[model samples]
Target: MNRLYHVALSPFCRKVRLTLAEKKIEVELVEERYWDPSPDFLRRNPAGKVPVLRMDSRLMAESQAICEYLDETLPNPALIPADPEARYEVRRLCFWFDDKFNAEVTRPIMNERVWKKIRKEGYPDSRAVKSGLAAVKFHLDYMGWLLDQRRWLAGDVMTLADFAAAAHLSCLDYISDVDWNRSANVRDWYAKIKSRPAFRSLLADQLPGLPPSPQYALLDF
Candidate 1:
């Protein structure tokens, strides 16, 4: 069986998990604390990231790379377009969510509200939490704009871009950091994504002290 070493709430791990599930790839999920890295885990991934996938005869690191490799290796249900231009758009949107959105919103809020508590680093920083809250509204509005123009972030087809966006949003939603009311379109889009079978494990995740929002596992929510 394939295996994935992951952190439950980490968006990068979530993205890889979603991709594997979408491809009908059955994997044993092993929760890993990447911050307090083990020597064996470091042997698998020098970067000490939570998402390290072991498949068939090889081990893969980096969420985007792993997803793309799966796309290329298992082409039955394609997540990336064949055309170069279309593929570029998908990659662009994936980066927008994973890099830009993460740096702007998810990391800040998760660090302040969740990671600090987990790491025993210090108390939550109200200023950082406030900034993350403020930034998320802008992101939701931007998502609304994209949804207004295209069925998905890149185009009509659901791609890695959607998974990438959902990964970050789901983490925020777990913490009740996201304001779904900010954009009805974005909310509806999220609901559609959340309803997928591939999202089940993610919705069922329970962090030790940081419980998910009440609506986290509600299918109708």
Candidate 2:
């Protein structure tokens, strides 16, 4: 059987998981402590990233590459658009969330609020959390603007871009960091995506000492 080495709350891992689930690929989820990487884990991915997928006798390292490969191999429910321009937009938005949003918001907030507690590294940093909270509002407004004009972030059809964005927001929402009421458009968009069958596993995830927020698993929320 195919297997995935990942951390439950990592947005990058979640993106790959979402893509796999969307395409109906069954993978054994193995929670790896990448911070304390073993030789076997490092051999799987020299980069020592959390999302290392072992599939079809191949070890896939990067999240985007793995997800896109799955989309290309399983074309039934295509996640990336066929048109070059549309494809570029999807990749651009995917990077927007994975890199920009992750750097400005997800990393900061999660590092302080979730990772610290999980790793037992240190206490939560209020300033960093506050900064991330402030930054997320801007991102929510940006998403709202995008959704205002288009059916999805990249286009009319749901694509990997939506999964990328949702991956980050869902992590934050797990800890009650996202203020869904900030943007009606974004809120509605999330509601639609969150209700998908692929989202069930993520909604069910519980970080031992740090349980998800009350509304984290609520479909109506």
Candidate 3:
């Protein structure tokens, strides 16, 4: 059986999970405490990331690479575009969310509010959380602006770009950090994505001692 070692709220793990679900791949989920990596886990992925996918005698590291490989092997529901230009746009947006937005918002917020508590490292830093919150508004506005111009983040079709963006936003949404009211377009986009059949598992995820927000599982939300 295929298996995924992941943290419930990590956007990188969620991105791979979404891609796997969308491709109708059955995977046993294992919650990995990445900070306290075991020797076996290290053998699976020397980089020690949460989203280590073990499938068909192959162990895959890197979320983007795993998602792309899945998309390539299961072409029925293509997540990456076939056209080079379109593919470039998808890759660009994927990086925008995973790199820039993660650096500016998701990583900082999750580090302060979630990881610190989980690791028992220290108290949540108010300044870091505040900065993340402030930065997220700009990212949301950018998403809203893109949605105003196109049906999806990369283009008219739903692609990995959408999944990448959704993965990050869903984590924030789980913590009730996203200001959905700030952008109607962005809110609507999220609502549509959140209602997908593939997203059900994500919505159902229950972290120990950290329940999702009320709106996290609400389709109308």
**Better structure of 1 and 2 per lDDT:** 2
The alpha-carbon lDDT assigned to residue 188 of candidate 1 equals: 87
**In candidate 3, where is summed lDDT lowest over 10 consecutive residues?**
67-76
lDDT of 1 by residue, 1-221 (tens): 89999999899999999999888999999989877888999999998787999998689999999999999999878999899999999999899988999998999999998988999999998998889888888889988999999988889999999999999999998988777888888888899999999999899999988889998888666
What's the lDDT for residue 139 in model 2? Answer: 94
Residue-level lDDT tens digits of model 3 in 86-111:
99999999999999999999999999
Tens-digit lDDT track of model 2 for 81-114? 8999999999999999999999999999999988
lDDT score, candidate 2: 0.94
Indicate which candidate wins on lDDT: 2
Model 1 is weakest, by summed lDDT over 10 consecutive residues, at: 175-184
User: Model 1, stretches more than 4 Å misplaced?
Assistant: none
Clashes of each: 0, 0, 0
After TM-score superposition, the amount by which residue 21's alpha carbon in candidate 1 deviates from its true location, in angstroms, is: 0.5
